[model samples]
Target: MLETHGLTANYGQFRALFGVDITVAAGECVAIIGANGAGKSTLMRSIAGVIRNAAAMVVHRGEPIGALSSAEIMKRGIAMVPEGRRLFASLTVEENLLIGGQARKAPGPWSLDAVYQLFPVLRERRKSPGTALSGGQQQMVAIGRALMSNPELLLCDEISLGLAPVVIRDIYAALPKIREGGAAIVVVEQDIGKALAVADRVYCMMEGRVTLVSKAAEVTRRQIHAAYFGEAA
Candidate 1:
């Protein structure tokens, strides 16, 4: 449902992505895996409209949206859970979630109660400051906040960045339920195992270019290792 064609990005002439092409089909889960500085997050930001590019660079369901603002993109049924889980420090857990929906009031299955159902602990601590939550709980709130927008495409950047294995597992375990709602997901992750485990297709990037693209079930660890390090097997 989303695709990028020759998408390039730069930070004041220091290019971060090089002619990167990728796609995520409706209701499918795609994983982007790479080492630090490999441009995974850059690609995500570009697609989500955080970094502006040529009008034809990014496409959603056949229309180019690369030039749209991030807020406009969210209104167009795409929401991003940024790398840092950048929740509003002053807002309570419930308030943070509430604001996410206020931006784009599209109708979907996600609601205050529905998000609470997805992460039960969020319901219990609805009135607590969002920053006061534990790391895993904070991550849950981030995900919940994104879902509040009822987006058709969800961009998750580094959802497992600093959490424990069990916590990561807990976060991933929510994917099936999320998918059941019919939203396509793009996960930018550093945890190879977790990425491969939940992805239908995988793309490995290195030094701002796509080095490998394969079906998750068909890709071998050796292939991932080779692509991740830019080496030939």
Candidate 2:
């Protein structure tokens, strides 16, 4: 449902992406894996409209949306759980989830109860300030907040960063439910194991380009290592 064609992006003159092409089909889970500075996050930002590109660069269902504002892209059914889980510090936990749905309220399956169901702790701490929560809780809030938008495509950037293995597992365990709710997911992750466990397809990037793309079961560890570091076996 989302695609990029010859997508190139730049911050002023320093180019970050080189003819990057990727695709995420409806209800499929795609994982993007790479090391730091490999342009994984850059690609996510470009697709989310945080970094503007030429009209022909990014496409949503065959329409050029590269130049659209982030809000515009969001309205077209794309939502992002950014790298930092940028929740409003002043808002309550429940309030954060509420705001995610503000942009497009013509909901399909996500609601406050559903979010709470996904992460039960969120319901118990619904009134607490978002920043007051633990890191795991905050991450849960971030994921729930994105789901509140009822988006067709969900972009998860570094969702496992700085979290414990069990916590990451818990977060990923919710993926089946999210997929059941009908959203395509693009997970940008550094933890290869977690990404491979949940992804139907995986793409490994290195130095601003995709070096490997394969079905999750089809890729070997050696290939992943090579793609991740741009190294030879």
Candidate 3:
């Protein structure tokens, strides 16, 4: 459903991605695992159009979307949860979700009620400020907010970064239902076990390039460690 070919990204002269290639087939769940400064988030940002790249960089369902704006990409069915769960602190929980549908409003399997069902606590905290929620609840709100867009591909960057183990499990437990709803997923995570547990395939990056791509079930822990740290196993 999504592919990046020779995707390179730069912030001024400091390039973050170096000819990175990635693919996520329809209905597939892929995870990107790498250490700090490995450019995992850079790839996600490029695909989401938050970081512009060359016209040939990112392709979605066979069409090029490298130069499109973030809003344009979201309208085209690519929604991102972002690295830090960047929710609008001023917006109420319900209001934040309501805004997520403002891009196109194309009818799909997701809506306010369905999102609340995915994270029932969100329903109870509907009127609370986004910042008032705990980190786990805030992450749920971020995921629910993305689902509100009813996207075909959901890009989750560092979804479990700072959450507790139980909270991470709770967050991941929502993936099956999300996949059942037919959204292709690409998750960028530092947690190897979590990535392996939920991803159908995994890609490991080092210094802005993909060094390893394998079936999650087939890739060994040592292999992941090597790719993550740029060391020989």
Among the numbered candidates, top lDDT falls to: 1
The residue-level lDDT of candidate 3 at 173 comes to 98
Scanning candidate 2 in windows of ten residues, the lowest lDDT window is: 99-108
Among the numbered candidates, top TM-score falls to 1
Each candidate: RMSD to true structure?
Answer: 0.7, 1.0, 1.0
lDDT of 3 by residue, 1-233 (tens): 78899999998999999999899998899999988999999999999999998777899888999999999999999999987888898999999998888865878999999999999999999999998999999999999989999999999999998999999999999998999999999999988888889999999999998989999999998898788777887
Instruction: Please give, for residues 1-233, the per-residue lDDT of candidate 2 as tens digits.
Output: 88899998888889899999999999999999998999999999999999998978898998999999999988888999999899899999999999998867666799999999999999999999999998989999999988998999999999989998889889999988999999999999988998999999999998899999999989999999888888884
Native-referenced Cα lDDT, model 1 = 0.94
Alpha-carbon shift of residue 30 in model 3 (angstroms): 0.2
Q: Over all chains combined, what TM-score does candidate 2 have?
A: 0.98
What lDDT does candidate 1 reach at residue 165? Answer: 86
lDDT values, one for every candidate: 0.94, 0.92, 0.92
Which 10 consecutive residues of model 1 have the lowest summed lDDT?
A: 98-107
Q: Estimate each model's TM-score.
A: 0.98, 0.98, 0.97
lDDT of 3 at 130: 92
Clashes of 1: 0
